[model samples]
Target: MSFGAHRPMSVLTWLATPVLFTASVLGLIGLGGMLLDADWRVALSSALFGPAAAVTVLLAGFVEWRTVRCRWCLGLGYPAVVFVAGLLLGDVTLSSPVALALGIPALTVLGVLMRRERNRVIPIA
Candidate 1:
């Protein structure tokens, strides 16, 4: 059942992280320039590349999520937070307070559920 030492995922999975990281750097740079109000090109590049950067970050998060062990917490936490943030991005004024209010209670409940689910036994009837 062992493929190799220190290589849990496939070769492509290993390659994907760095490739996405390198490709996303240009987009991130564009975003920084846009933030500074540098010029039209900066704005254009940021508009064009921002989604790529966001997607790359999400992909990286997903890859990391799969590596940890948990009934659900390890994999779901990052994406769940990201989803909530995205959901609230349109109303930035209220996003922080809302995220905190919603996130804390939801995560607390999730932790309790995870603990409860961890040791469930199914009868082999």
Candidate 2:
């Protein structure tokens, strides 16, 4: 009756993490740029991208949440906190595609780590 014990994630779910993480990172970059210049038009345009990013991150989180029993969502959480910190500090242009590129590999590594750490977390069946 424990959480994440009833079902584990598929290999495809693990593989999708990088893709989801990358999309979210890109969306955050767009969001950051829009917030920086006080351009309402840009802000509006970028704001529209936020939900998709949030959803992608959330799906990645859900995969870990339901299978690994570790808060992979927190992986998504750190960048969000940093982004908010940047926005609040008026460092909007700090966004970088390179940083986003790094996130894809990081999430891939995380996925592999999770799979290695707990076989139960990954549904081979």
Candidate 3:
């Protein structure tokens, strides 16, 4: 129940799933709009959100599979997968300066957390 009790990396991995899933779905809708109207704005919107979703879901699934928590995995996995698929195949782009800025910090945090967790799990032998 407490934040400190749970592994930070695992918790973040789980959290990212829903966020990515939502972004993917929204991106898809935006892509659809672009397709219907041939507008760059719609396409750009879709591209931006879609990849964000995919990354989140991917991280979540990776965590779930690694940790073997079915409930959490299922809760996070399906949406993330769907979003990723949409991003790849849907009429959306996945590149942005803002995304690059945000991704670096997010990835760094995850790496740090994972490293800390790994240290905790290893024996000092």
Tell me, by lDDT, which candidate is best. 3
lDDT by residue (tens digit), candidate 3, 1-125: 44443333455555554444444444445545544654333333435545555565555533524445764766466555655655665564443333334445555555665566666552344
State each model's CA lDDT, in order.
Answer: 0.39, 0.46, 0.50
Could you give candidate 1's per-residue lDDT for residues 46-122 as a string of tens digits?
Answer: 33234433543444432423434641553344334444444444333222333234434444554554454444354
lDDT of 2 by residue, 12-50 (tens): 554444445444455455456544743332122233334
**Which residue pairs collide, candidate 1?**
none
- The order of the candidates by lDDT, greatest first, is 3, 2, 1
RMSD of each: 14.0, 9.6, 10.4
